[model samples]
Target: MTYIWTGKRWAYLAMVIDLYARKPVGWATSLSPNSELTSNALKMAYESRGRPEGVMFHSDQGSHYTSHK
Candidate 1:
């Protein structure tokens, strides 16, 4: 999770990167960092990548990632 300054206020930015391409595949912003934020970014990446199977995910061990949500 990263905090971005939007000139007026701070926002949370979540991103999914394509390691092979070293580029961002998907991203999402929210006022708060939560499961929904990361989930949405992953969802976008999944859809963009044609929904590949047997994919693995990694995270920074944040509560949002560990949460049941």
Candidate 2:
């Protein structure tokens, strides 16, 4: 997760990168750095990747990533 100065308020961005491609496969931005922001990025990556089976995900265990929401 990272933040950007929008010249007024801060904006947060979440991204999911494909290890194989070494590039971002999904990304999302929001005004709030919360579970929803991370969820949105994961959801996009899952769907865009055809919802493959037996995939494992790793994270830095940040609160947003570990949230129940």
Q: Highest lDDT among the candidates is held by which one? A: 2
Q: Estimate the overall C-alpha local distance difference test score of candidate 2.
A: 0.95
Q: Give model 2 RMSD, 1 decimal.
A: 0.7
Residues 7-64, candidate 1: write the lDDT tens digits: 9989998999988878888889999888999888988999988999998888878887
TM-score, candidate 1, is 0.88
Whole-model Cα lDDT of every candidate shown, in order: 0.88, 0.95
**Model 1 worst lDDT run, 10 consecutive residues:** 60-69
lDDT of 2 by residue, 5-48 (tens): 99999999999999987989889999999999999999999998
lDDT of 1 at 12: 98
In candidate 1, stretches whose alpha carbon ends up further than 4 angstroms from where it belongs are: none
